[model samples]
Target: MAEPKNEEFLDDIEDAEAQAYAEEMEEIDDEALELDQLRAERDQLRDRFMRALADAENARKRSDRDRREAENYGGSKLSRDMLPVYDNMKRAIETITDEQKEANSALIEGIELTMRELLSVFKKHGIEIIAPEVGDRFDPQHHQAMFEAPVPGTKAGDIIQVAAEGFMLHDRLLRPAQVGVSSTPAS
Candidate 1:
């Protein structure tokens, strides 16, 4: 009976040790799972942060391009509106007769001064005049042909008449010069 009791006690201790080892292994597995979850969360957050940073940089570049375009072309409409005033003044100057100029010398001088001031302002604002002569070759990019006529002693595509002068605003054509082209046949 004493020997049987000793064997039972040893069996109970072995069972307890096996149970403790199983619990320790379970705890280690739980810790490993928790660490894996933390790593996955950190990777997701890093990816999102990198994408947001790229989007912000693209927006800044787009806005800078818009600002530059606005600065360069802000006064385009106002400059275009001022063209007819220049044409009318030029016509007035052209129609003045010699007798009229002699009689109204002071008035003519005032008009001339005003015209000069207007041209000076145009030059300051990057406006240029496209003055094509009657005998020069016609250019379709700068001249708009109003009519085609076979004028004597003129070659084909020659500029016969210039009805209205052209204007340019900083390398862009505001108005093309209205002209008449010669359609002469070759001799």
Candidate 2:
């Protein structure tokens, strides 16, 4: 009878200990789950922060590029407006009669001086002229051919005459050179 009582007490103690251990394991598992949730939230927040930072950087770069372009092309309209005056000055110098030039050296000199001053003004404002002389090869990038003339002593596709001079403002083409090209003579 005494041995039976001792066995029952031992069985009860073992059951109580097993229950306590199971409760402790459950608490530990709950803590681990909480920790995992916190880590996942932290990772998501970090990714969002990185994306926002990248967007800000991209916007800053875009703004800087826009500012630079504005600075580069600020005077485009003014330069374009002044092109006709320059062209007229160039025409005046080119169309003078040789006899008039000889008879009135002072008038010719004054015209030449005015043309030079106009060219200087163009250089100051970032406007440049494109005029290819005769015998120069015709380039489609800067020259537009009005017609092809059959001539001798010149290669085909060579520039024979410049009908209208071209102009540019800060590496941008304002006008295309109207030119006459040469073709092979008829055999």
Over 4 Å off, model 1 = 1-54
Query: Number of the top candidate by TM-score?
Result: 2
Model 2 alpha-carbon miss at residue 75, Å: 3.3
The ten-residue window of minimal lDDT in model 1 covers 68-77
Residue pairs of candidate 1 with colliding backbone atoms: none
Error of 2 at 44 (Å): 2.3
Model 2, global lDDT? 0.87
The digit string of per-residue lDDT tens for model 1 on 1-187 reads 9988899998888888888988988998898998899999999999999999999999999999889756655666887798889899999999999999999999999999999999999888788999999999999999999999998899999999999999888778888999999997545
Candidate 2 stretches greater than 4 Å from native: 1-20, 96-118
* Candidate number achieving the greatest lDDT relative to the actual structure: 1
Instruction: State each model's CA lDDT, in order.
Output: 0.90, 0.87
